[model samples]
Target: MSPAITETMIYDALRKVIDPELRHDIVELGFIQEIDIVDDYVHLEIQLTTPNCPYAENIVAQIKRAVEGVDGVHRVEVERACMKGS
Candidate 1:
């Protein structure tokens, strides 16, 4: 059987997703709000620096791609939330 999926594995994968404007990985930027994993599905809640960030869509896409590339990940769901008072 394949290795079980874990939060560490997912986080490691997400570390590769970089913020285009900040030029730093999202994980390092602390944009990841939450991560929920069930079976092969991964749900992520990300907090952006701004509510109207131009790269929001791109960031979401990159997040999904990054998580999807992880072994044993069959599906990915990403939710975005703007930082409070930002």
Candidate 2:
């Protein structure tokens, strides 16, 4: 059997998704939150700096793409929320 997916692996994958405006990865930007894994499925929330961010859709797509690249990940479900106090 293939190796099980871990939070570390997921985070590593997420590091490749860069916020075009910030030119920085979401992991470093601390936007990733509430990572939950079940079997081959992954669920996570992304807290954007602003609710009206123009790039939100693109960012979510990138996040799905990145998370799906993990070896054992069969599905990725992403939710978006604006950061508190933002």
Candidate 3:
């Protein structure tokens, strides 16, 4: 059986996701707005620097792959958000 997934594991995995343009990890850039785990399901929010972010898909895909790589992750629900700077 796969080992149980933990919040630390999720965050650590996300730390490896780098933003192509910024050349920094999404976590480091404060892109990860929220993270929650319900049973084996993982629901997270990734806030972008802009609504029409060109790298949105790539970032989401990276997050999905990372989260799914965890042993006990049954599913991942990624909600995208935009935070436009003033």
lDDT of 1 at 61: 95
lDDT score for residue 86 of model 3: 37
- In model 3, residue pairs whose N, Cα or C atoms come closer than 3 Å (at least 3 residues apart or on different chains), thus clashing, are none
Rank by TM-score, highest first: 2, 1, 3
Task: For residues 1-86, write the lDDT of model 3, one tens digit per residue.
Answer: 76777889999999889999999998899998889898799999989888888999999999999998888898999998756553
- Give per-residue CA lDDT, model 1, range 1-86, as digits (tens): 55789999999998999899999999999999999999899999999888889999999999999999989999999988767875
Residue 58 of model 1 has an lDDT of: 97
Candidate 2's C-alpha runs over 4 A off are: none
* Candidate 3 structure lDDT: 0.89
lDDT of 2: 0.92
Each prediction's whole-model lDDT (CA)? 0.91, 0.92, 0.89
Cα RMSD for predicted model 2? 1.2
Better of 2 and 3 by lDDT: 2
